[model samples]
Target: MKKLLSIKNIIISIAALLLVWEILFLCSSYSKALFPSPLMAFYALIEMIRSGTLLSNIGTSMYRFAAGYFSAVAAAVILGLILGRLPKVFQYINPVVQLLRPISPTAWMPFVVLLFGIGDIPAIVIIFIAAFFPVLLSTVSAVGNIDPIYLKVAKNFEISGSAATWKVIFPAVFPQIANGIHLALGTAWIFLVAGEMVGAQSGLGYQIIDARNNIRADILLATIFVIGVIGILLDSLLKSAEKRILKLWGLK
Candidate 1:
């Protein structure tokens, strides 16, 4: 009942916000060309949905996002595990990692474009960069921060090598790693759109640019709304997955 009420409140809040937006739009002096009303944006969204352009753009974005995000997660987790197990290796790479970590994924656009040219490749590469560091750092921290007693207990139980690492270390640190993944997911989505804006000819970001070029504020606003909705859905999906995993691991 509490959960249902919470969801009801959320719906009510959203409706209230939309009402406020409509009121503001009615009062504002900005032309419809410059600032579209929510109703106009909703009409544009319906048009896009009917035309199939919205689905196509979303599909393209998802393809690029999945490819980049999964690869980054795999690579980062493996490297993080290795580095976490070997402090010397981490120390040796720490300087280079730190130097590169601070660089924004958007800042890499010029180099990425020059290297990969104008297409999905550059966008995927940018997403990978956006997703990698957070997971890597978080995994490393989680592993390194594990209580010493757990390590001793594993050793005492004759749990050694890969078995120990997977059964003990991974389970213990999963929450922290999940937190990192959640953070990276949001970051990757942001960079994916920004990357697509500069590199790809399709996807939500490209549509925004196309809408602006064509002087369609309604379409632009609708695309932005879709992006926000997709972002929320993505986070919600991750949260659900995290909860399931935690339950399986007896951490929930």
Candidate 2:
């Protein structure tokens, strides 16, 4: 029942947005080519799907996204686990992290492209940079904020070192870490498009640029819609994964 309500709400919200969009297009002085109606964009979406261009670009973006996102998260979580256990070490490192974290991932695109050239690497690197800091900081903070009684309980059970960190500490801090992961998903996904726009030959971002170059407002709008839909899907998948993990660990 809850799921059905959620789906119904989503449909109603989307319909309302489309209605507003069509109204704006109707009221605007701009040409249809310059400001496409929702129906025009839907037609353009169908055209892209028929051409296979949309699917190919989506695959490329997903490949880069998966490569960069998973690797960064894994590295960040591992390092965070270690750093969480060492407050003094983190104190020394936190300043450097703070210094670097504020910089936009896209700001590095020029340098990244210079080194990696116009290919997957530059976009992947951008995504890595975008995702890394959030998870690392969150994990470290979560570990630091863990209740002392949990550690005591683990110690009482004769658990120590790797066992304690993985079995006790990780589970205890995961709720907090999950927040960072969720945050990173949106950040990294946004940068993935931006990075692709600057560095890659093909992807949803590039599709936007391509459409603009050809003066295809319908296609551009369609691609924008696709990017938004994909972001929502990715968020849903991550949430589902988080739920399963929490359930497995008896933490949900």
Candidate 3:
């Protein structure tokens, strides 16, 4: 019932948005170059499909996203677990991490490019930095916030060491970890595209940049729409996965 209601709500919301967009397009007589209508954007999307711009661009962006996001997740989880379990070591490293964490990923791009050159490597590195701290910080906080009773329960069963850590603590703290992962996912996407825009021969980000330079407003708007649609899809998938895990843990 909940799922059905959600689907219905989504449909109605989309319909309402489309109606508003159409109304705005008709009521405002601005040049299409200034504000391309939804219909124009749709046409532009179709042209993109025929021109093979959409697929290749989206694929390249996804490749960059995957590289950075997966690496960040792995590194963050390992670090989170270590810091969470060993507060003394964590405290030693926390100040340096906090200093670095405050720096914006885009601010690091120039250094990354100087170090790695203009290529996928820099993009991947930027995405990793954008995503890493959030996940790591979240994991540390999640572990710290875990119920003491859970640890006691594990001890009652004579569980200790790595077994206790994984079988007991990790599962219990999953909800918070999921939040970190979710944030990292979106942040990675943002950084990936921004990195791509800086220096890329292929990618949705580059496609939009190129279209803007060429004064193709429709194509530019279409690319923006594509970015938004893909972002929504990726976030929805992550949230769904989170929901599934929560249900598995009886925590949903």
Candidate 3, residues 41-123, lDDT tens digits: the string is 88989999998979988998899899999999989987897799888889998999999998888888888878888878878
Off by over 4 Å in 3: 1-12, 15-31, 153-158
Candidate 1 lDDT by residue in tens digits, 90-177: 9989889899999999999989999989889988999999999999999998889988988999999999988988888888888889
By lDDT, the best candidate is 2
Give me the runs in candidate 1 sitting further than 4 Å from their true place: 156-159
lDDT of candidates 1 onward, in order? 0.92, 0.96, 0.88
Name the weakest run of 10 consecutive residues (lDDT summed) in model 1: 77-86
Candidate 1: residue 224 lDDT (0-100): 92
lDDT at 110 for candidate 2?
100
Ranking of all candidate structures by their lDDT, best first = 2, 1, 3
Could you tell me every candidate's TM-score relative to the true structure? 0.94, 0.95, 0.88
Model 3 C-alpha lDDT versus the unseen true structure: 0.88
* Model 1 TM-score (2 dp): 0.94
